[model samples]
Every structure is written in structure tokens, then in C-alpha cells.
Target: MLSRVANNLIWMNRYMERGYSVLNLLKVNYSAHQDSPDLFPWTPIINNYCGSDSGFSSENSIECINHMIFNLDNQNSIINLVTRSRENARSVQEHIPRELWLGINSYYLYLTKPELPNKLYQEDPVVFLDRLLNHQLLYYGKIDITQERGSAYYFMDIGKFLERVIQISDLASMKLKEIAKTSDALERSFLWKNFLLSIGAYQLYLKKYKSTFQEDFIIKLIFQEQLFPKSLYYCVNKLSRHINQLIQTNELVNNDLEFLLGKLQSTIQYTTIESINEQGLTNFIASIKNDITNISLSINNVYFSNQS
Candidate 1:
């Protein structure tokens, strides 16, 4: 594969994954703020996940939300992600099919228009989010149906799967900490539901467990479920499969990347929630984050960097 094509494929996946991440964060924060009257807390979420929240420096809920959601200065915002994705698509327009590029371009242009953000937030936030999600789905579907199943496809899969693994781990860590600290069962239950909804896993959870919300079961389902797409284990497993396939066909292998992924996957596969909680959830999550960071660097070395 050409270096330029590989770069485009990687970036295309990254941008879409970022847009989805921002959308999920916005939805979760919005629901939490709306449901809990006293808990008008929003800044912590922005600060933790998005570095741009620091610019606002205000504890006010509405102000922080507006700044995070609408301010173009926040490069990680939904609009900004969409814009960047379009720019990435533009850069590789010659490599991608014209129709596919046009679809992404049109979507971002619509999102970047001056009036869309205000109208979206004012007219109906949920509906606006739904529309954005639908567009994301459309782009993903287009890639699946239109793109060839080759090195480029594998790179795209790597980007999407890795992003999902990191996002789910972060969400689980954040929400589990909240649950552990909270004394009120009702609040815990609400937070757990919100976490599931943020990952688009609520309905799936209900279908799989057929039981009321409980912390242990929720943790198991989110972290360990092999069949669930958003689960960290599932994402890592899928990533490994793709990487192995790439190695086999291209005769290109990176031992460091494989070792990191294998170790992370094994840890998740064998460990129990009891051990995780007893040992300290924060430490376990931090370890996983380190592993992921290493795996990403290895991936760049093997497939993305010019030196590779």
C-alpha cells in the first residue's frame, strides 16, 4: 500500500472515532446534568476527557457546556472533529472513491455551517445527536461496502477498534469510581444506566442480563463480555485478529505490538472483577492505559511511520 493511502485510511478512522467519542461524552454529560438537579457538575468531565475545557475556567454548567459543545476553539468538539474528518478526506480525495468523499464532505459542511449548532442545541439536542450518529453510521457503512478488504481496510479497523477500547475503559473507570464513592443506591443505578446508554449498550444489557442493574454485573458485562462490540475485551480481541491477519498476509510482523496486545488481552481475559476491585480499580485501569499507549506506538512504528 502507498504511504499516503495508509495515512489517509488511518486518519479517516481516527476522525470518525473521535466524532463518536465526543458525541457519546456530550450525551452522557447532558443526561447526567438533566437528571440530577443538584449535581450540575460538567466541568470535571470536560477537563478529564477534553483539555479544551480549561479555557472556560467557569464552574457554571451552561457556560461550560456551551463552550465545550460550540466553541470552535475547542478542537476536540463534535463540530471540530467533523471538520477535521472532512479535511482528512479532502487530503486523500484521489485515493477514496468520489462518492464516498462527497458524502463525508457534505456531512461536515452541513455541520460546520454557522447556524447548525445553535439550532441543534435549541431546537432539540437529542434529535440533533441522533442525526449526527446516523451520519456516522452512514459513513461507516459506506466504508464497509465500498472500500477494498486489504491493508487499508485493516488500518481502518485498527483505528476504530483501538479508539473503542480506550473509550470504554475510560468510561468504565470513571463511572465505577463514581459508583464506589456514592452511598445512594438510586444515584448509583442512575449513573450506571447513563454509562450503558453512553456506550449504546443499555438495550443490549437488558437483553443479556435480564436482571436489574447491579455494579458487579454491569462491570462484568462492560469489561468482559466477548460478544459485546463496545466491551474492552472484545475490541482488543478484534484488534489482535486484524493485526494477526495483516502479519500473515503481508509477511510483516512487529513483535512489540503483538506482545503488548497479547498481554493486555490476556489480562482482561483471565482477571475477575473481584480481583480488580480488591487490587484497586484505578491501578488496573492505569495499567491498561499504559498498555494501550504502548500498543499504539508500536502500531505507528509498524504500519504508520515512514521509518517502518
Candidate 2:
């Protein structure tokens, strides 16, 4: 496969995964705002997801949500992401399945509807977001059912897992930063609940940790629980498997990438809640995020350098 095609495939999946995660964050944050209006501020979310230059430094909830969802100028907005995802897929249409392309194109067209912004602003926000979320689910379903398990599949799968891990880390880190500011047990539990729900892990958290929301255990679940698909350990493990398959089948000679991935996998696998506390949660998360960034750069340098 051409490097450009591979790059497009990876970026296409990354945008799709990122847009879905952001939608979840927006929906959960909206609920959190209603549940604890004083505690849940939109400024931090804006800064974290949208760049600092997004010009929405102030917290106008409706305005922020609208901008994040519809503003093409905001590069990280859902509309922009879906647009980019479709563009990337279009560039490599032959490499992907027909159904997948149509699904992506349909998603892009849905976002283009002028009434969406007004609907989200005027009507029930959850319903509006859920409709888009369901669209994403259908798109992903098409990818899984239609795409063959070939090199293209591996590339896209890697993109999906990589983007997921990055998002999990960012969301967990943001919640942890907020958690650090307050010592109130009740507030901490609320924050943790919001965090879990943001990543669609709340029910599993309740099932596995029947005890009152223990902070350490929640951290453990998100960081290393292999059963949880969105956990850092699980995503990294899947990323390693996909990369390994690519290596074996393609006979790619990229030692730096393999080494970086192996190191990251080992770090996540060996990390414990106790150790995380010892290292300080903020510092520990920073390290993991840094490693993930390095891995991303290594992949670009090795596989996609030929582009441009």
C-alpha cells in the first residue's frame, strides 16, 4: 500500500473515533452541568478539546456547545472531524469497503444539516447528541462488518485504538485534576461518576466495584482493567497486536516503533494504583500521555514520512 493511502486510512479512523468520544464528553458534561451547575464549568472542557485559541474562554454553555458541534473554524469540532474523516475516506475510497464509505459520507451529510445546531440548542440536547452517537455506531458497525481483515483493516484498527487511548487518558486526566481540587467525599464521588459515564464505563464500574466509589479502584479500572475495552491497558494491548500483525505480514522494518510500543505496553501493564499514588496521579498520567505521543510520532516518522 502507498504511504499516503495508509496515512489516510489511519487519519480517517482517528477522526471518526475522536468525534465519537467528543460527542460522549459533550453529552456527559451537559448532564454534569445540570446535576452540579456550580462545579461543572465549560471553560476547562473548551480549553482541553478545542484549542486555547478557540476564543470561547468564557463559559456560555449553549454557545460553547454550538461552536464545538457546528463551527468549522474550530478544527476539533464534530462537524470538522466528520468532514475530515469523509475527505480522508474519499481519498482512499478504493482501499475501503463501499458500505464504509457510504456510512462515512452519510455521517458527513448528517452533520451538514443546518437545522442540527438549532435543534441541539432549542430541543433536548441529549436526544440530539444520541442521534449523532447512533449514527457513529452504525458507521462503526459497517466498518466491522464490511471491511476485510487485511492491511487496511490493521491500519484503521490501529488508528481507532490509538485515538481511543489518547482520549481516555485526556478525559481521565481532566477529571483527576478536578478531583484533586476538592477533598469532599461526596463531590469526589460525583466527579468520578461523571468521569465514568463520560467514557461509558459507569455501569461496569458499578458491577465490578460494588463498594462505595473508591477513587483508587476507579483509577485501577480505567488504567489497567483488561476486561474494559476502553481501558488504557486494553487499548494499548490491541494496538500492539495490530502492529505486530502488520510487522509479521508486511515484514516492515521499524524497530523504533516496536520498541516504543513495547515500552508503553509494559508501562501500562505494570502500573498499579498504589504505584500511581506514589508517583502522583498527575505525574503518572503525564508520563503515559508522553509515551503515547512518542509512539504516535514514531509511527508517523516510520510509516507516513513519505507523505509530503
Candidate 3:
């Protein structure tokens, strides 16, 4: 595959996944803020996840939701992400199947419509977010069904799960940071549940843990659960496998990517939650984020463009 084609395919899916991550974060936590406006102040979450809650009319739910979804100036907004995703896909249109291309383009067109912002804040916020969320599902499902299982397929999958690994870790860190500030048990559970729902892991979490929601158990579930698709461990392992496949195909000798991936997986496997507690969750997650950033840079250096 051409490097440009591979890069576009990779980035197209990365932006899509990222957009979904942000929108889903809002989706899972929105109703609670709506129900109890005072008991729960949502500014911390907005500030932590969406950068800052500034420039909006108010930090209320509608305004905050608008900021995350419709503020084109915010580089990470859903519309920007979908736009980037489609543009990248456009760069490699020949490589993409017809149905997948149509699906992505259709979603992008829906988001770019001028009425979206008003519809979100005035008519119904959940419906707008859900429509976007469902679009993500449909686009990915089209990819699974239509795209051939080949190098292009592997590259796009790598992009999705690579972003997944980072997002899963980062969201956990953010929710845990919020959880630490609260004294009430109910609030702790609410934050934890939101974390699971954001990643579409709530039911799987319930089936596995059943009775316990301890910090240790939840950390283990997030970081170490091999069977769960959204776990950090699972994403890392899958990413390593995809990169290995790419290396063989491209005939490239890049040790940095493999070594970092191995070290990350080993740390997650051997380190216990007790040891993580000693380091503290904030510091621990910060280290994970740093490591993942380094790995991403190394991969970009070697494979995508401007090869070292």
C-alpha cells in the first residue's frame, strides 16, 4: 500500500473514534446533570475533558453540549472530527469501499448542516448526540462488512484501537480524578458507571464484577482485563499484533514500536493495583499517557510519513 493511502486510512478512523469518544462522554453524563443541577456541578468534567467551558453563554448543559459538539473553533469538536475523518477518507477514496465511503460522507454531511447547533441546544440535545453516536456505529459496521481483510484493513484497525487505548486510559484517569474529589459513595458509583458507559463496557463490567466496585477492581477491569475489548491490555495487544503485521508487509525494521508495546503490555500484566495505589492513580495514568504518546510518535516516525 502507498504510504499516503495508509496514513489517510489510519487518520480517518482515528478522528472518527475520537469524535465518538467525546460525544459519548457527553451522552453518558448528560441526564444526571439535567436531573440534579445543584447536587452535581459539571464544570470540572467539562474543563477536564473538553479543555475549558469558556466562550459559551453559560456552563449549563445545553451550552456545554453545544461547546463540545458545535464549536468549530474547538479543534476537538464532533463536527471537526467528522470533517477531518471524511477529508482523510476522501484522500484515499479509491482504497475505501463504496458503502463505507457513502456512510462516512453521509455522516459528515449531516454534521455540517447549519441547523445542528440550534437543534442541539433548543430542540433536543440527547437526540442530536445519539444520532451522531449511531452514525459512528453504522460507519464502523459498514467497514467491517464491506472492506477487505488486507493491509488497508489492518491500518485502519490499528488507528481505531490505537486511539482506543489512549482514550480508554485517559477517560479513566479523568473520571477517577473526579471520583477522588467526592466524599459520597453514590457519587463515586455514578462516576464509575459513567466511565464504563462511555466505552460501551457497562454490561460487560457488571457481568464480570457483579458485586464489587472497588477502586482496585475497577482499575484492574480497565487496565488488565484481556477478554474485554475496551481494556487497555486488549487494545495494546491488538495494536502490537497489527503493527507486527504491518512491519512484515512493509519490510521495515522498527524496533522502537515493538519494544514500547511489549514494555507497556508487560507493565500492565505484572503490576498490581496495590503497586499502582502506591504511585497514585493520577501519576500512574499520567505515565501511561506519556508512554502511549511516545509510542505513537515512534510509529509515526517510522511508518506513516517523513520516515526516519
Candidate 4:
């Protein structure tokens, strides 16, 4: 596969994953706000998703929803995510299945409807977000059914798990920040529940833990649990497997890339939740973020580099 095509595929799926994640975050936060307007604030979300550098801040839930969902000027908005993902798909139409292209194109069209903003504003916001989130799920289903197991598919998975790691880390960071602001157990519980709900892990959490939410157990669940699809360990482990497949097929061969991934996987896989707490959650998350950023840079230089 051409490096350009591989790059496009990686970014295409990254955008898709990011858009899906943002929708869930918006839905969860919106519902949380309804439950306790005083406890849930949009500032952290705005700063996290809107890009702190964008200088966009809104306390009003409705206005934030408008900016996040519809404002094209906000580069991270759902509209832009769909637009960019579709554009990427359009560029690599021959490299992807027709159904996959249609799924993304349909997603773009849905977001383009001028009434979407109104639907969120006037109608139930959760329903509005769910419609879009379900579209994302359908999009993933199409990929699984249509895309063959090859370099193209591997690259898409790489993009997806990479984006998932970043999103989960960011969510953890935001929730931990909020938890730090208050010592009240009720507020802490709400923050943890909000975090899990935002990531679609609440049900699994309840089933697995089947008990009260403790900080250690919640941390273990999100960061280390192997069965949980969204856990950092699972995502990182999947990412390693996909990248290894690419390397085994000789589609990608970079010692630095392999070494970085190995180090990252071991860093997560070998550490205990007890050690993580001792090291401090903020610092641990920061290290993971830094490692992911480096690994991404390495992947770009190794496989997607113009020189390659």
C-alpha cells in the first residue's frame, strides 16, 4: 500500500473514533447536568474537546452543545469530524469498500442537516446524541463486514485503538481533576459514575465489580482489566497486536516503532494498580499520554513518511 493511502486510512478511522467519543461525552455530560446542574460543569469538557488553545469557553450547556455539535468553526465539532472523516474516505475510495464509503458519507450528510442543532436544542439532547452515536456504531459494523484483513484494515485498527487510548486518558484526567476539587464522597462518586457513563463502561463495571465504587477498583477497571474493551490495557494490547501484524507482513518494519510499542505495552501490562496510585494518577496518565504521542510520531515517521 502507498504511504499516502495508509496515512489517509489511519486518519480516517481516527476521526471516526474521535467523533464517536465526543458524542458519548456530550450525551453523558448533558444527562449529568440534568441530574445536578451545580455539580457538572461544561468548562472541563470545553477545554478538553474544544481545544484549550481554541480559546472557546462556555458555561451554558445549550450553547456548549451548539458549539460542539454544529459549529464548523470549532475544528473539533462533530460536524467537522464527520466532514473530515468523509473527506478522507473520499480520497481513499478505492482503498476502502463502497459500503464503508457510503456509511461515512451518510454520516456526513446526517450531520449536514441544518435541523440537527435545533433537534439538540429543542428535543431531548440524549436522543439527539444517541442517533449520531448509533450511526457511528453502524459505521464500525460496516468496516468489520466489508473491509478485508490486510494492511488497510490493520491501519484502520491502529488508528482506532490509538484514538481510544487518548480519549480514555483524557476522560480519566478530566474526571480526576474534578474529583480533586472536592472531598465529598457523594461528589466523588458522581464524578466516577459520570466518567464510566461517558465511556460506556458503567454496565460492565456494575457486572464485574458488583459492589460500591471504590477509587482503586475503578482505576483497575479502566486501566488494567483485560476483558473490558475500553480499558487502557486492552486498547494498548490490541494496538500492539495490530502493529505487529503489519510488521510481520513486512508492511511496516521499524525497530524504533517496535521497541516503543513493546515498552509501552510492558509499562501498562506489568504495573499494578497499587503502584499506579503510589506513583500518582496524574503523573501516570501524563506518562501514558507522552508515550502515545511519541509512538504516534514514530508511526508517522516509519510508515507514513513521505521519504518511505
Candidate 5:
């Protein structure tokens, strides 16, 4: 595939994945707020995931949520990601089909309307986020079904899976920290269940563990389960498979990426929840984030950069 096409595919997936990440975060926090009214702090919620809480510290929940959701300055905001995705789509307009570009462009324009912000923040925030997420998923489904499954598809898959892996890791880390500090059993269970729901894994988790809510079981499912798509191990395994395909096809030959992914897969597959707890789950999560960032950089060097 041409380098420009590959870059466009990679960024297209990245921007859409980012949109989903932010939407998931917003949905989770909103649910938590409903459950624990007094404990819900919107600012920390924004900061914990996207690091955009600093600018809107003094604002009320409505204002803060609006700013984070609609403001262009918040780079990770839904509006921003939509805009970025459209920009990426524009760059590769000739490479992608016209229908796909039109769909993406329509969504981008929908988000930027003058009245949309008020409707999203004041009338119903959850619905707004859900609509945004659904639009993104629709675009992805179209891409998967319509686009040719070639090198471009591989790069797009890499971006989606990698972004998901990193986002899930950060969420796992944040939930672990919250669980460790909280002393209330009720709150703990709510938070734990909320974590699962955040990743859309609660039902799967219940089925796997027979509705058991043990910390160890949750950790194991989130980290080790290969069937769960959001699990660290599953994401890494998917990434490794894509990387291998790239290598076999001669589109990419980055042994360093293979090694890094292999290390991550091995660690997640072999490490125990007990060991993670003993070593500190936060620290372990931090390490995983660093490893993922490093692997991403390696990919950029080997595949995306001109020097490669």
C-alpha cells in the first residue's frame, strides 16, 4: 500500500477509536454519578481519562460537561475527534469511497451545529454520547464490510485495537486505584460493576463468573481472558496477529514491534492477579501503558515515518 494510504487508514481508525473512548468514559462517569450523587466529580472524571479537567475547574457539572463535550480546545473531546476524523478522511478522500467520506462528513457537521451543544448538555448528555458512539460504530461497520481487506485494512485494525488496549489499560488502572482507596463495600461493588459496564463487559463477566463479583475474578477477566475483546490479552493478541500478517505480506518487517507485542502478550498471559496485586496494580498498569506507547512509537518509526 502507498504510505499516504497507510497513514490515512491508521489515523482514521485512531480518531474513531478516540471518539469511542471518550464516549465510554462519559457514559461510565454519568452512570456513576447517578448511582453516587455526592461522590461524582465531573472534573476529576475528565482529568482521569483525557486530562482536560484543568481548564474547567470552576464550572458546574453542566458547564464542565458541555465544555469537555463541545469545546474545540479539549483535543480528546468528541467534537474534536469527529473534526479530526473528518480531516483524516479528507486527506484520503480519493483512497476511500465517496459514500464513506459523505457519511463521516455528515456526522462531523451534525456535531458542530449551534443548538447541538445545549441539547447534548442540558436536555440529555447520555443520549448525546450514545448517538455519537453509534455513529462511529456505524462508520466502522461500513468500513469493515465495504473496504477491501488489504494493507489499508490491516493498518486500520492496528490503530483500532491499539487505541482500545491503551484505553482499557488506563481504565483498569483508574478503577483499581479507586477500589483500593475506598473502604465502603457498597461503593466497591458499584465501582467494580461500573468498571465492567464501562467496557461493555458486565454481562460477559457475569456469564463467565456466574455473577460473582470478586476482585480477583474481575481482574482476571479484565486482564487475562482471551475471549473478551476489551481485555488486555485479547487486544495484544489481535495486535500480534495483525503485525504478523503485515510481516508475512512484506508490507512491514518490524521485528521490534513483534518483540514488544510478544512481551506484552506473554506477560498478560502468564502473570497472575495475585502477583499483580502484590506488585501493585497501578504500577503494573503504568508499565503496560508505557510498553504500549513504546510499541506505538516503534510502529511509527518502522511504518509511518519517512526515515523508515
Candidate 6:
């Protein structure tokens, strides 16, 4: 329950979650364009997300892969994310299970290899990204069976969902903006499905619902589907539960954290697709982004800010 441990847990998961999401973005764009122009959409997106434009403008897909996979300048790069996540895992090694700690260390070691950039560039970057994502997903799968289901687990869960919710929201926002400007219906349809696919929700969506692709359907699926783990609703619900667990375990008396998450989750739960259509996707997604930021700040204030 120490602030240091909590901070490390949140950050370790944040970096890893963001790393996986970025890899997903790379996979989506590279898979779409690898055969023809070799250029990828991630350079601009990464440059925008990381707020640094030093090497992104001229970098082709392969060069951008080098920067994203191994560059030290980009803090959001996989190597740095793995490095920082592993460092935080090291800090809490004794608290978490050996399997989880070893997993983090092994991932870091894999990224630190000298041949990674060459392999990423030469051997189908999307394949490499997919493999890395599977490895990361495998690593996360070990947590539930191995790690203790106490405050530590709750802390890590909060970290994972918090980062995930934000990433999906941002990507969804980007896709919505792109979709809004498209003149062709076919392109809009593709963009709508692409948005779902980016977050790993496409197949489940296809199997579950038989609706034709529309912006509202995709947005509703991403935001309203409680069954989909990657959806905004699911993430928020999971986050609120973890927060409740933390409250019970620590006997913390913070009410604002509960209130903030409660309001957000309730809005997601009660609002129907009709209401979301009326409110507008851009506005709805933007408000959720703001609420998540506020919740994160509130968490810091309540649990970590005052710890000495």
C-alpha cells in the first residue's frame, strides 16, 4: 500500500499497455499498406502522441520501426516502455509472484537484443509486432493464476485498464475524425471497421452482431458493449471494481474517487445508442477522455500524493 509501490505498479502497467496499443496501431497500418507504398501511418501518429517530430517526418515504415522499436529519443518506444516497466517490476519484485517478475525481465531482455531492429525491419514488421503482442498477451495471462489477488493485483488491474481505456479512446477519436471527413461511403465503412479492428474487437463484433457497418454501430460497440473487454464500458467497469477492491483492502476513506468513477460508469451504462447518436461520437469520446484524466489525477491525490 506504500505510495512508491502503487506508483510503480501504475506506471509499469501504463508503459506496457501503451506499448502494446502502439504495436497494434503499427500492425493495422502496416498490414494495410506494406505491399504497396511501404509507408506507414504511425510515424505521424507517434510524432503527435509523443510530441516529438525529430525523426518521424522522413522515416519510412522501416526507419520508423527502428525509431519506435529501439530509439532512445522516443520515450513511448517499445524498448523504453519495456525498460521502464521492467524497472518498476523490479521495484515490486518481492510483492508480486516470481512468474510475473520473470516475465517482465524476460520481455525487457528480448527488446534489448542487438538484432531486434534488423529483424523488425527485414522480416515483415507487422509479423514481428504481432509476435511481440502475443508474447505480451501471454505474459499478462500469467498474472491471474500466479499473482496474489490482493491490493497488489487490484493496483495492477487499475493500471492496466486505466492505460487501456485511454489508448482505445484516443485511437477511436482519431478514427472518428478521419471518418468524419471522408467523402466516400466505402471509405467511411472501412474506417469504422478499422477502428474496431484496431482494438481487437472486430471478430467478436462480426460474430455477435449482424448489423451492416456504420459509424454509430462501431462506436456503440466500442463504448457500450459490456461483453467486450476492450470496450470503454468494460474498462470503466473493471476500473471501478478494482477501485472498490482497493478501498476495501486499505479501508481508504476517499469518496471523490468513487464518485468520479461512479458518474462515468453510470453514464456509460445508462446511455443507449440513440442517446450517443444524439450526443455525437466526438463529444462523447472527448468527455470520456477528460473523465479518465480526472480519475487518474484523483487516484494520485488520494493514494499516492501524500505518501512520504
Winner by lDDT:
4
Ranking of candidates on lDDT, top first:
4, 2, 3, 6, 5, 1
After superposition on all C-alphas, the RMSD of every candidate to the true structure, in Å, is 2.8, 1.7, 2.5, 2.0, 2.5, 2.6
* Candidate 6 lDDT tens digits, 1-308: 78789888888788889888988877776665464342225544665566654645644677766677788978878888889889889999888889888888888888888877778757977688877897688678888789888888888888899999999988887776666676878777676776777889889878877776866667677888988989889999999998887787773446588999998998888887888889887788888999998899887776664311
For residues 152-195, write the lDDT of model 3, one tens digit per residue.
Answer: 88889888988888788778777777777889998787777777
- The models' CA-based lDDT, in order, is 0.74, 0.86, 0.80, 0.87, 0.78, 0.79
Off by over 4 Å in 4: 53-55, 305-308
* Candidate 3 TM-score over all chains jointly: 0.92
lDDT, candidate 2, at 222: 89
* Residue 173 alpha-carbon offset, candidate 3, angstroms: 1.8
Residue pairs with backbone atoms closer than 3 Å in model 2 (clashes): none
Whole-model alpha-carbon lDDT for candidate 2: 0.86
Give one digit per residue, the lDDT tens place, for model 4 in 140-246. Answer: 99999999988899999998998999999998999999999999998989999999999989999999889877988888888889989899899988888998888
Structural similarity to truth (TM-score) of each candidate: 0.89, 0.96, 0.92, 0.96, 0.92, 0.93
Write down the worst ten-residue block by lDDT for model 2.
299-308
Off by over 4 Å in 3: 38-40, 53-57, 305-308
Candidate 3 versus truth, CA RMSD in Å, comes to 2.5
Model 3 is weakest, by summed lDDT over 10 consecutive residues, at: 50-59
The 10-residue segment of model 6 with minimum total lDDT is 35-44
Instruction: Identify the superior model by lDDT, candidate 5 or candidate 6.
Output: 6
